[model samples]
Target: MYDVSPVQLLIIAAAGLITSVIGGVAGYGTGALMPLVLVPIVGAEPVVPIIALSAIFNNVSRATLFRDLVDWRRVRLVILPALPTCALGAWGYTLLDGRGALVVIGSMLVLSVPLRRTLKGRGVTLGNGALATSAAGWGVLVGGTSGAGIILISLLMAAGLEGAAVIATDAAVSTVMGVLKFGVFGVSGVITAQVVAVGLLMGVIAVPGAWLAKRLTERLPLRVHTAILDAVVITGGAAMLFRAATF
Candidate 1:
């Protein structure tokens, strides 16, 4: 377990609080942003599990706040394939070195931006089968990495969801994925006492952030939300890559 000073603890909690607000709006910024703060403090080895554990609280808050808006059909579509595939990804995560996992996580975030813009411009749409296949791929990445939520947001947007529905549905799916990751990491001995403690603290502190985001979402324009999301993804991904390279 890595020892954290009170100041570092404050930083981590603050990160959760801040990112959860963005996540509440975008359905993704927490995972994309939190690691940029965490990996350096705790090192890469425990960051994924820590974030996964913390995400349970963050997602639950969003899912609950936006319960009425959740697209259950889309939730089922993503979760069905993600269930088995995410387990496989978690298993795979156990085999990767810290640098490899960080690189993968970083690369996924960076690449997803261009991919999202391209797909948006092309106006590509996925049918059920294709959507399921894409969910499976996301399952693997999300199970193993820190920033795969952006990809899910893109997929949901492409599937015709907008505004609250996108955030709500993504939260529902992500909540389940977080539970799955927690179990896998727990059983695999990846979740240590320090991880649990930090995760719980961060999660609790983020609750208000989620509430705040819900309020903001009602007023925020979709175009503004999209722009902020892209900026965060790019910056977070670049930071992770820089850390991995230096490591």
Candidate 2:
């Protein structure tokens, strides 16, 4: 029931386009940026809905662009754990205030980097139990923070997936995660007509941006692509911290 101005709608659309490109090229970071920027524009109540919708669009774009390279096995590993924990996190989010939720989410984002780096290339093959536990943890974290892609990206990289495969599988998993989060938000009364309308408008623009990113991805060197992703992760993590503190 929130009323968005024409200028605000345009801003949201532009943010969506930019976030899609970042998500498409980097495999993460879009969600981290969404709540940070949109919360102030639309207020905290609509932030999760906007983020969920944007995520749904982002994943759809990524899935469409990299359909051929998706790794089903990797996707399973992340989704298995993420689904349930995300639900729990979403439920918790509905009960908490924006600042409280942001604090929790922001801390997770900042902590995930060190966690990923320490765990990176360690050859720690996750069994069923480990996978489920990690997924639940990530889901809860992502449900609150909107950065579900972070854990999955790190796991995929550590699992030794190549460039296209990593992006494709991550996108596929994000699609599922986004759907779950959207449902949770909808049921919690967080998603409204205005939020959906603005989100869908943004989604329309995101498709092209994602496609452009995919084309760009093809031209970049592997190291350069990875560096870009790393930068996004670090920058996003920092942004989350700043937002949590200030807001």
| RMSD to truth, every model | 1.6, 2.9
Predicted model with the maximum lDDT: 1
Report lDDT per candidate: 0.85, 0.73
lDDT of model 1, residue 134: 95
Summing lDDT over every window of 10 consecutive residues in candidate 1, give the lowest-scoring window: 217-226
Residue 161 CA displacement from its true place in model 2, Å: 1.6
Off by over 4 Å in 1: 221-225
lDDT of 1 by residue, 1-247 (tens): 4688999999999888988988887677888788788877887778888888889999998999999999898899999999888988887887778888788778877987888788778887877787789999999988888778888988888888887898899999999999998899888878889999989988898789999998888687868777877887888788888878988
Instruction: Give the TM-score of each candidate.
Output: 0.94, 0.84
